[model samples]
Target: MKLLGIDLGSREVKVVVMENQEVSQQFKVSTMSFYRDYCNFTGKIVVDLKKLGVEDADIKISTGYGKNNTDLEEFETINELKAHVYGVFYQTELKNFVLLDVGGQDVKVVRVEKGLITDLELNEKCAASCGRYLENMAEVLEVPLTELAEYSQDPVELNSTCAVFSESELIGQIAEGAKLERLCAGVNYSMYKRLDPLLTKFKGKRLVISGGVAQNKAIRDYLKQDYEEVISLAEPQFNGAIGCCYYGQLTGEAENRE
Candidate 1:
């Protein structure tokens, strides 16, 4: 069976095609471009699958930021947490693990025990510990987002509880002639600090990091100190979509057996 999964995030739209529970193809595009060019915003967002080069999919599922409003017919919608957990399990061999998904506008910490989510936490009130904060900081530092994770080796001291104030603090560090690498490390550390509190209540030996920020090496390195093993998905950004595909496959197989 061929399945199409779509994860419409605040910043990007991730799509994946799976054949017999294995990934066949995947693509990602900035949400702004997707909205402006491909989507028709008539009450609900609609995309032409053929225009997007996806056709004749046996099953279609959507999740993430705008899943509720996606105008795709004969589609199933799953919650982000379920999608993320399934994505992690499908991609890795680890059955017991914690899932950390830091998206453009929110962060989710999920504890998986015996292949099911037992506990979870979410920070939707602020973007401080999310990917958007890191993007803003990288812009202030005049560095590429891809390079920001590599710039931090030894993070200096930065104590800003708010994302808005952290920018000012970063400016002060720059004026103090702090090494760029150290400042970048400070940024990465600050994000980790924000995440640590939310994850403290959960106890999982392994961690599966997903989302755009999972691509950051510094964040992954810091996460390793706390987790027995820190695993990053092959396509961190596509985890949600992949999870949807997994869900589709599971149900499709069940129906066939029935």
Candidate 2:
């Protein structure tokens, strides 16, 4: 059967096509480009699935920040955290794990045990703990995002909790001749510290991460300290959409892929 999942995120839109219980194709597009060119805002903005290389799906699902605003009458809508948990479970056999999704504007932590969601935490009130903070820090350090994620073991202790002040602090560190790597590491570590409260709530032996920041090596390595291991999907950014597809199949609403 074929299932199509679309995640209408803040910065980007992620789409996944699943056939025979496997991800057949996946892609992402900038949210602005999608809305300006593809979305048809008659009553609600209708996403053009065909433009996303999807057509004639047996079942379709939508999720993320913009899910509620979509004009997909036939597509089912799922909560972001629920979709994230389902996606993680579908990609692995693990029944117990702490899921952390660090996106552009928010961070989400979900605790799942024995195929059920037990507890979850979200940090939407601050950008300091999210991917955007890292991006700004990287810009301030004059290094690529990949390079900035390289140093986390030993950090310079960025004390400011506000995203704007943190950037100013990083610039001050630069003027004071702190090593570039150290400054970058400080940014990474600071984000980890901001996430401490959420991580403390969901205690588990395993941690699974997804979303934009899942590719960060420094953050992933630091996260290992709290859990025995930290895991991520092959397509971490598309996990939520993929989970939506998995949910469609489980509900017996999907038919053969044609």
Candidate 3:
């Protein structure tokens, strides 16, 4: 059976297709383009599967920030936490771990024990601890995001608590003749510092990181100091969508057995 999963994220839409419980295809589209070109708003935004190029599926599932706002015809909706947890389970096959999914505008830290969520923490009130902060800092530094993520040593201190003010502070550091690498490292380190408090409450040796920020090497390096193992998903950004597919497969199998 073919399973389809879509994650309507804040910045991008992640689509994943699975056959016989294994990933077959995965892709992403910008959130703006997805909404403007492939969706029609009639009280809720209706999605076009043909335009999305994944028209064949036995089951369809969706989860993310925009799941509630989008009308996915015949598609079942699941909460972000459940989707992410399932994604982590599918990707890492680890039953116990700490999951950290930092998205464009928010952060989620979930504690999973024996394949079930025990506790979770969310930081939606600030962009300072999210992916947007790194994007903005990269722009200010006139460097690629990948390049900015390479620095993890001797980071300059960025003392701003707000995302907007942090940009101003980063500019000030640049003017002060600080090394380019240090500035970039500072941005990554600061984000980790912000995340540290939220993670302090959760005790786990292994941390499974997903979402867009999972690609940031500097941030991952920083996290290594705290955890015994930090696992990065092969398809970090596509995790939620993959989780949906996994859920579909699980439900399908259960129904068949019943």
Best of the candidates, lDDT: 3
Residue 105, candidate 3: C-alpha displacement in angstroms:
0.9
Candidate 1 C-alpha lDDT tens digits along 85-194: 88987888677888999999999999888888888899998989999999999999999988889855779877988999999999999999998889889999999888
Candidate that beats the other on lDDT, 2 or 3, i.e. the better one: 3
TM-score per candidate: 0.94, 0.94, 0.97
**Winning candidate number (TM-score):** 3
Show the colliding residue pairs in model 3. none
lDDT for each of the candidates? 0.87, 0.84, 0.90
Off by over 4 Å in 3: none
All candidates in order of TM-score, best leading: 3, 1, 2
lDDT of 3: 0.90
- Minimum summed lDDT over a 10-residue window in model 1 is located at 66-75
**In model 2, which regions exceed 4 Å deviation?**
66-71, 253-258
Cα lDDT of model 2 by residue, 91-111, tens digit? 886788888999888899988
* Model 2 C-alpha lDDT versus the unseen true structure: 0.84
